[model samples]
Target: MFMDLDALSDIIVLKHVGHGLTVVTAGVDRIELAHPLTEICDLEYSGMVTYAAGGSSVEISCKVARARDEGEPSRPEDLLLTCIFTMVALDPVTRKPVAIPRLVCETPDEEYLFQAGAARSLERRTERKTSLLEVAPDDEESALIHRIWLQQLKYRDRSHPLRQPPNVLAMSRTQLATAAIMQPQYRNRHQTMIFGGYHLKQTFELAFCCAASFAHARPTFVSADPCAFRSPVPVGSVLYLTATVVYTDPAVVEDDEAQDKINKDGGDSESPALTRVHVRVDSKVREMEHGTARVTGQFHYTFTVPKDVRVLPNTYEEYMKYMDARRRVRAGAKSHRSLPVAGRDGPNLTE
Candidate 1:
């Protein structure tokens, strides 16, 4: 079961399904780096079907772990990354969701996994309705917004070198973007649309750049929020990605200028200072015949940097994005606190 992800083959063949039908990721429910991979080592990967809905949708759980010696069983501590993905079969020509075979659980463990996946899926749908994007800022968020606005107003004029604090940056200044044509090589197994993994890679790279720029230090990835694919990008279409710092969790740190001076007077510090950075990437696609672009995906990434930094929203739109990212960060922290690290054992087949 441990193998290269791309080499994995389909386990189910729906009866009467069209020959050219393709499967696509409906959403990435979660992707968390449980621990860092600090050294070069052989990696093992495994995945299993956790749940299947009435029609085409199914939930899959995947894990990446360090390869163990022969005859040694995998432990939860071996896991490096854990992911949950929702996928659906689609008609190639029409790009519509297609009905597929229903999953038949053959064991009690399988049934448990099925039920757990169902509950998580339902919770995700329910949570979307009341997400930060759909609701107005609460009292505390409003106060935070006003405080950020006041800080920016006082430091708006960069013409004077001392006006802006070194630790704070305008959200607009942290944007990093890229655009590309969806080439034939990027097509998925369906051969009709660009691959979802390709899109994820693009977004992650740009988000990393945005975070690094904002923090002025190399950033280490911590996690990624649930990312939804709104539309499939057809081969030959234009894809545009924009990544920016939407939130920052500033931690106590010595002044960067003072720290640099200390390092210069003495020797470099043994370890780098670190703080959390949140970056969001928005993707849009435009076909050759269309004059406008349509949103295709949204990705949020969390990283840690070696310096204290803050992102201040200077505009209404930026404020909303900032709030959305803030809410996601808090939600992630709460979820992690409730769940056991890795699992009681290793990655659970029933998770």
Candidate 2:
């Protein structure tokens, strides 16, 4: 179910010795090869994950990615290597990923790992079918939710305790969306699609703006979900990345002493009183002519705020977003676990 990352060094050896040319593996996604062997090895897909159904026709994304030989590359002989965090399976097949590659697992445990990933992809697809932001011609549930939110505005008293006072700090949903398009140059030449890492970085940048504004300060990087590259963002497509501050620290109100101390000390580097917020980002894209945005990726982040800012959700929709964020965070905490890999960027599950 889990492995010491050091075992990958041996597995990489087995690849050259003929078990398989490529290691079909489930681990932290990184591209590592031996020296001199690195000459023609200019592919820089660090922490990129590709997940697809076993069926044919896997589409890869080519959005917001560009080739840059900026970071150090890994070699087989390197004493310590990154991206070997969690090895549930490995594939030795020699073929390249024309479409998304299916797991060519060697054992039940390996298949088990791959299956779990596939299941997650499926679950995301199902959720995307009717996300709150998605527009459908006849989506009754979505319409109902919207109507219910609107109805609350007419019936609820303005002076009620359920809503934030007019003078309280708050954030608007208006600043949450950014519109952009994917270009041909963003894709990998060989694969003709965007690298997962590139998409992730770009998405994080957008989320940072939303989180920073909502937190009223710079937020510390916590962790992100292992990318489940849901679908490809084709070249020449418009992209809409929505970053929502779903939840803000619920503590700063009750413990003014600690909040004041943190505010003064700037959230002591390791202090538990650090203001925290959960931000969720969804990647959506559509054809240049089409108006509807389909979900491409789902990412969640937890950041510790450095300010004593207050985020009051003033409306039904805003209130629901806060509550939903809290629920998801709770669910994630229940199922999350971490493995101590030697050189991991982020754990497959959580850190």
**Best model per lDDT:** 1
Q: How well does candidate 1 match the true structure in TM-score terms?
A: 0.83
After superposition of all CA atoms, the RMSD between model 2 and the true structure is: 11.4
Per-residue lDDT of candidate 2, residues 188-250 (tens digit): 322444544456667778777877877567876654544445566767888788887766655
Task: Show the colliding residue pairs in model 2.
Answer: 24-90, 24-91, 33-75, 61-194, 61-233, 62-193, 62-194
Off by over 4 Å in 2: 1-168, 171-174, 189-191, 251-273, 314-320, 343-351
| Candidate 1 global CA lDDT score | 0.72
Q: How far is 305's C-alpha from truth in model 2 (Å)?
A: 0.9
- How many clashes in each structure? 1, 7
Query: Which number leads on TM-score?
Result: 1
Cα displacement (angstroms), candidate 2, residue 315, comes to 4.7
Looking at model 1, the pairs that clash are 76-346
